[model samples]
Target: MTTIGILGAGQLGKMLAEAAAELGFKTHVFAPDADPVAAAAATHFTQADYEDIKALQKFAASVDVITLEFENVPVAPLKKLATPIYPSPAALEISQHRVREKTLANSLGIETAPFAAVRSPEELRRAMETVGVPGILKTCTLGYDGKGQWKVATPADAPPLPPGDYIYEGFVQFDKEISVIVARGTGGEIQCFEPVENMHRNHILHTTTAPANISAEIAAKAIHTATTLANALEVAGLLAVEMFITRDGHVLMNEMAPRPHNSGHWTLDGCNVSQFEQAIRAVTGMKLIAPKRTAEKVVMTNLIGDEVNHLESWKKPGAHIHMYGKKESRPGRKMGHVTILSPRD
Candidate 1:
């Protein structure tokens, strides 16, 4: 059996392993976590730090191909791995840095919120002026789920800038936030899932509804933006593009994830082919198929932190519950999710 190596052992990795098993592939997960959540589902597991070059090399040699569940996996270590890794390290590099990712998108003629790079307090001041107030300052790399972000409400609200490369982006007044997950095959064939609407609480994803209530024109624009970035990056795995739709119907690119995204979790039970399955298929050079909705309407709610305790409550019909095997839940931690499908009213 071919062994697929995964670089992270998070919940996403667990789902990918489950998908791989369905296709007759064994999963070998490598991560430093002592109790990786993915170990429960993966066929094999390796506990090692991402910087452990020797371990990465051994893991690479053991698997037929390698892929990552998260974008923050160090690019330097990936370059040393001889095994072919899908989505490419270059793609990972760009996705790791907010500045680079947005710059590339702008170069591709994709619209993004006004942004400026900041490496110093002086630069921060200039960026705020250039991008305008009521903006957000985010670290250029290594931040997610609202971490490493600070909001600048006014000139007087500028806190002491943290010491790191940051990007200042003007706030966008949007009607709705949506995301599209696109999978590309080795032959350059692309399969895009229908755009989905996302709702956030405390800057963390709260719920996602499939087939966003937007005009067909806006939907087409969203898909085009996603596909354009995927093709430009030559991604062979899943590339999820998150965007903001202005009240006037303009689509502005938000950040992106070059792997199965949290927003795409609805696809697990609501679509003919889930994002996790598409991720594994893409890395393995399999055909990418168009995703068909299993229901007219689908809603996926995240079980954040202690919310997992209510798992039993979500067991009603049409509600697909998935709990990550996390031993403890802390504030802002994602414990699991429940995807519910129902007919449109």
Candidate 2:
């Protein structure tokens, strides 16, 4: 059996492991955690820190193909692997850094929010003048789930952050935040899922509704942009493109993820082919089917922290509960998520 290796052992890796089993593919999960959630379903588990080059090399050798579930892992070492790593190092390099991701998006003729880079107090002042107040200050690297970022609502509130460089982005006047999860095979076949409208609590994703209330023109643009990015980056696996839909109906690139993203989790039960399957197919040199939306209205709610602990409250019919089997949880931690397919009320 062909074995696929994943570089992270979080919920994303768990979901991917489950999907791989269904498709008759073995999954090898490599991570530093002693008991990663994915290891339950993983065909092979290699617990090693990201810095352990020897362990990584051994894990890479055991799998037929390799892909990463998280983009935060550095791309330098993974590039030296023998097997093909889907989405490629170029894609990881771009998505891992916010400044590079946004800059590449803008260079592709894709419009994003007005922004500037700040590496020092002086640069922060210049970025403030350019992007104005009510901007988001995000670290160029290692920022996810609203961590390593801050919001500057007013000029006076801009903190004296001179430790490291960050990216300053002017807030987009958006009606709603939407995302499109697109998959591209090794041969350039692309499959685009219906846009998903997202709601965030404390800058962390709270819920997602599929078939986003976007015009066909805007949706088309989103798909086109995602496809362009996949090809441009020579990405060989699934890619999730997040966009800020302006009040005027224009789609502005917000960010891109080089893996099975949180926004696409609904696909597990809301589509014939889940995002995990798509990622596996794309990386294994198989054809990626154009995703068919399973629910007319797919609504997904993230069960974060204590939210997942209250499992009794989510017993509503037609609700799919997927607990991540997490041993512990903390505030703002992503414990699990639930997806519901019901009428759009």
Once fitted onto the true fold, the runs of candidate 1 whose alpha carbons sit more than 4 angstroms away are none
lDDT of 2 by residue, 231-279 (tens): 8888888889999888787888988989998999899888888899999
**Tens digit per residue, CA lDDT, model 1, 83-175:** 998889999999889999999999999999999998887887788877888898889899998888888876556677658889989989889
Best by lDDT: 1
For model 2, what is the C-alpha lDDT against the true structure?
A: 0.86
TM-score for each candidate, following the candidate numbering: 0.97, 0.96
Give candidate 2 misplaced runs (Cα > 4 Å).
153-156, 160-162, 343-345
Scored by lDDT, model 1 comes in at 0.92
lDDT (Cα, 0-100) at 69 in candidate 1: 91
